[model samples]
Each structure stands twice: as C-alpha cells, then as structure tokens.
Target: MYFISTSSPDEYSTKVDRMIGENMDLTRDLEFWMSKLPACLRALPIIYLSIPGSHNSFTSNISGGSIVSLDSPKILQNLEWIYCIRHIMANWTKNQNVAVKEQLKAGIRYFDLRVSAKSRENNLYFCHGMYSCKVEPVLNEISTFLETHSKEVVILDFQHFYGFTQQTHGKLMQMLLKTYGTKLLPYSDHMDHLSLDYMTSQFSYQVITVYRSDAARFGQPLFWPSASFPTPWANTIDHNALFNFLDDKIKDRKDNVGFITQIVLTPTLTDILFNSCTTLEQKLAIDFEDLRTGWISKQTPGRRGVNIVIGDFIDLSDNLFTKTVINLNLKLLRDLPKRMTSPIN
Candidate 1:
C-alpha cells in the first residue's frame, strides 16, 4: 500500500527548494492513495468523497510562445522568453505543468478541463484563453489511468467551452460518448450506499462527467449541469482573500451538490508586471504549509466534508497538496465502517 508521511513539512519544503534550483520533478510517481483505501470508505458516495484536482490542468504545456500564434516571428518568441515577460505571462497562463497521467498517479482524481475547437477540421483542444494540447490524447491518458486503476474513480469536469459553434459542442459530446462509452457514470438522484458501492467496485465502470453546455448533454444522464457542481471563480490576487472567499462558499455550500474548493491565486495586472520575478511554483511553495495546517486541516469537520479541492501546481513539491487532500480522505476512512454500512440517502 502507498504510505505518505504527514509528520514532516520538510519533505515538501526540500523538494520545492530543489525544484527551483534544478529541474521540477512534479510528476514523480507516488502511491495510489485512492486504490489503497479500506473497503468501507471506498463504498461512500463520491460527491462526499475528498478529491484533489487541478485548475486549468491541461495548461501545464502552455508557455508564452505557445500561447502566441505559430505565425509569430523568431524575434518575438525570443523576446517573450525573457525572464520578466515569461514570469508575467506565467501569471495569466500555466497553472500546471505535470501531464494528466502523472497527476493520476499522484492521487488527483478530478480534472478541471477547458475545451475549444481549433478549426473546420473539428479538432478539439484544451484551452484557457489561449489553447494548449489537443483534447483526445489527454482523454486517452485518463482512459489509460482508469484501465490500470480500476478501484479508483475520477471526475471529468468540462467547465469552460470556447471557440465552438453549437454544432461543435454536439460533435465534442459525441466524441466523448464514443471514446468513454459505458465507462461514464450516469447521474444519480440519490448517492445511496448501493449506488456508491456499485460505482467504486473493481468490476464496475467509473467516471463522473460534469459538462457545462446543454447542447452537449444529448439527453444523457451522465452529463451534469454547472449548478449541480459549484466551482467558484478565484478572481483575486490576495492569496488570503482567495482562501477566505472559498471558505465563505464552503461554509454556505449545499449538501446535495458537489463543491470544488479552488485553491489558487488570480494575479492582477499589477501582480503580473510588478511581481514578475516570482513563479507560480514559488508562490505555491510559500503558501503550502499555511494552507495545509490552516485551511485544509480545518475543512474536514465542516458539513460539506470537502468534496473536490483543486489548486494550481498540484504536482508541485512532489504532490504535497495532493497528498494532503488524499490524506484528508484517508482520515475519513476510520469512521467509514459505521457510515458505509448504514443506509445513506
């Protein structure tokens, strides 16, 4: 079984310091925490389950030059790569850098995907203002992860759609249905004990798809509306305020719907230009300990019980925050023997 030592912050601190000095090995494989859960805890409703996710998960590949058009000249590309501009550009773009499969291994069960169609060729790509890699390959990676880790379930939330005609949305939905097929879980009115157990069983299929557009729903029960999944926007530069905003939402959240605690800082124009030297990695590193002890640790006792906790740089510092969230789930397991056996509606 996978074991995570929660006793020391130094393990993460040292890793982050090394990353800044050398290569960033955020994708280094770790133990599969979800699959290691006790049987009773595994039987709980996924909406009540604690899940770690990435905000703009597909944007790890986005750089300043990549966000710009391919037609741009070499000179422009070179200038954009300069330290200040790159850091500034990093603010708006590049929330994550680790690939999807790596994130899966690191115990991230939820993926916050933004999709866009590129051209008449009908190619769909992952996007956040500007585009990144194509969508299908990433989905393929997720599929591969699911295949290997049958006991583990994942949440695919297509929260944003851009550069798409109405027809494109339908096409995208068709593509997803075809690709995922029966593996996708249909919507359930009540996340009772039986349904939860069935969904998480090794023999049963898994995937909770939350699609933003109604055009793409295709009357399929698998697709959930935005209202059922609340992913509050983090439009603030103040790190503390961002957490406070999420804290307020968490306090007021409805038990029926799933919640996404977006732990990220949205840098304003001033933060971008003035604080150009600091990378997203550095910011996350600085805030990591405080967030773990002050924010995430305090969340387990709340009514909602922390559904999906998303953040930028999930794979950073060797999956520090991801492990923290997963450990929170593990912490829930001790009480599960009683809860799981009881008839939960």
Candidate 2:
C-alpha cells in the first residue's frame, strides 16, 4: 500500500530482541524459579519436599593417590591376581565424576562426604576406601558456590571417618567451624520446619553439617547425629535387590529426620572381575536411564516421592539422572500454592 514503509534494520532488530525476552522459557531454568518461589511455599517443611543429592560427592578425582593398594610381597605384586585387584580398585573406588561445584550447579542440594586422615600427608582427605582431594579445597569450592547462589541450601554429611583418632576428629571440627562459621546451621529439634527461604534469610548461605561420630561432637553445637539423618547404604551387586531396597526405604518417611535412598548400583569383587572391560559409567548408564524413565516416574501422586535419592556418577555426560532427580521436586512445586493455604497437621 502507499502508507506501508519498512522500518530501519536496527529498529527491526530491537523489536525481535524484545519479543524473545518477553517469551523466554523460564521453566527450563530450575535454579532461577526455585530462587523465586513464593515465601509461603518456601515456609513448608523441607521433609515434605523431594531434595536432590549426590552420593560420595567428592570422589571426582579418585585415581593415583586415591587408589587402594595392598602392601604385599614383590612376588605377589607381579601376579595377575594383583593386577586384577588393582583394576577392581579403579572401578570400585570411583563413585562420582562430578566435582562439588558442578554438582551444586546441577541442583544437588545434599552431599554425602566421608573424610579420613591421610597417613602420608598431614591433612584431611575425602575417602571412599581410598583418599581423594584434601578437605579444605572442596569446602572452599562449596563456599564459593554458596556465595554465588545465596538462595540455595546444602547439607554436608560427614557420615564416615577412617584412620582418624579423637584428636583428629576435634581438629577436623575446628577446621570446619573456622571455614563455615555462621553459615553452618545449628543443630535443631525442628528440622521439618527449616525452609530454604528461612535458612537463607537467617544465614546468608546455610550449610547443615551432619557429623556421624560422637567424638566429633565435642562442644560442637552444629554437629548432628547419624540418627537424625539416616542414609541406609545398599551394598549389593544385584540391581533388582537395590531397587527393592530403595522402594521400601522411600515408603518409610520420618517427620524430622532426613532420609537418603541410594540409587546407584553397588559392584562387589565378583562384579569387577567379570565386568572389568566395562567402566563404571558404561555399566550405570543403562540402569540409570531405566530407573529414571520407568521406576522414578511411577513414584508420584500417592507417595511423597523421594526425600533424597543419591547416586554415583551424578553428573553424567547428559545430566539426565540429575535432571530426573530435580524434576521430582517440581511436582511438589505444582501444589505449593494450594498446600500453603491448607492447615498444618
């Protein structure tokens, strides 16, 4: 028509940019929406929600120094038996491939940390049979992540300690307190009511420390007992048995106590020798996919879903397992507004 004139290139570009921003798919960004969840919804008990977690979260670098090797005779070391055992150690020792920072970004809010005193070095190391990185660097990485994501909360469960004396435990506690200080959430009887919003509001970056040993609790008000947070480990080689155990565990939910359902398949000595050609990643990929697609989906509606479902290799290549775990929590978010208005039992 006579009145129709094309706009300038810059003007057209600006219009397109505005349209894209307005129609942005925010649902894809879990962390952004999680941070912006309504205060009323945030006030709900944490136990009622599905929390994403990682098992043996600090074993990303399990090799070399972390390898579990037996001090044997030179003759024994040269035998094929010794070689097989070394290969087994490589497979069994590595439980995770994602470091702390990467796991945090993938919506992992709970971390199962096992620390041990290294005989060769005068430092605390994260141990899953063998030792990995020093405790301080991992703590620093977590601290840095918390600094950036102030709205998030993380649980640091020191559930196991090897080669540590009472004094060593005390020293570790001192280091922890010194590092986290006020960010560490004090031990409380009312764990259910501890909402993410409340925690972040109270402490800038909240970290709930669960200490397993009684010796580590000396004068440390922040240390929580193993009873308060129970993570029943499935030490079985059978995938069917593992699923059955996790299913039964999920059904039995406690009020104030934190529960963990271990989702990863445990490989015994026999598994390693038989499946030596296959890596841990390769072995778990198919099982993880099946569980995410088949078993996990059927857990909604009647059940509260899972409290915390942890696994090995949490940060898989595609992060499919981690996303599945996070999506479990989204189902609760769907009913947040309705639940927020309902009466508390």
The candidate that achieves the highest TM-score relative to the unseen native structure = 2
What pairs collide in candidate 2? none
Task: List, residue by residue over 215-280, the lDDT tens digit for candidate 1.
Answer: 755577867777777888768866678777887888788766778888777765566566566765
TM-scores for every candidate against the unseen true structure? 0.79, 0.81
Query: Candidate 2: how many backbone clashes?
Result: 0
- List lDDT for all candidates, in order: 0.67, 0.67
Residues forming the 10-long window of minimal summed lDDT in candidate 2: 336-345
In terms of lDDT, model 2 sits at 0.67
How many backbone clashes does every candidate have?
Answer: 1, 0
> What lDDT tens digits, residue by residue, belong to model 2 across residues 99-200?
887777777788898887765778888877555778988898888777777887788988888778888988888888888888888887667657777688
Colliding residue pairs in candidate 1: 60-96
Displacement of the residue 189 alpha carbon in candidate 2, Å: 2.0
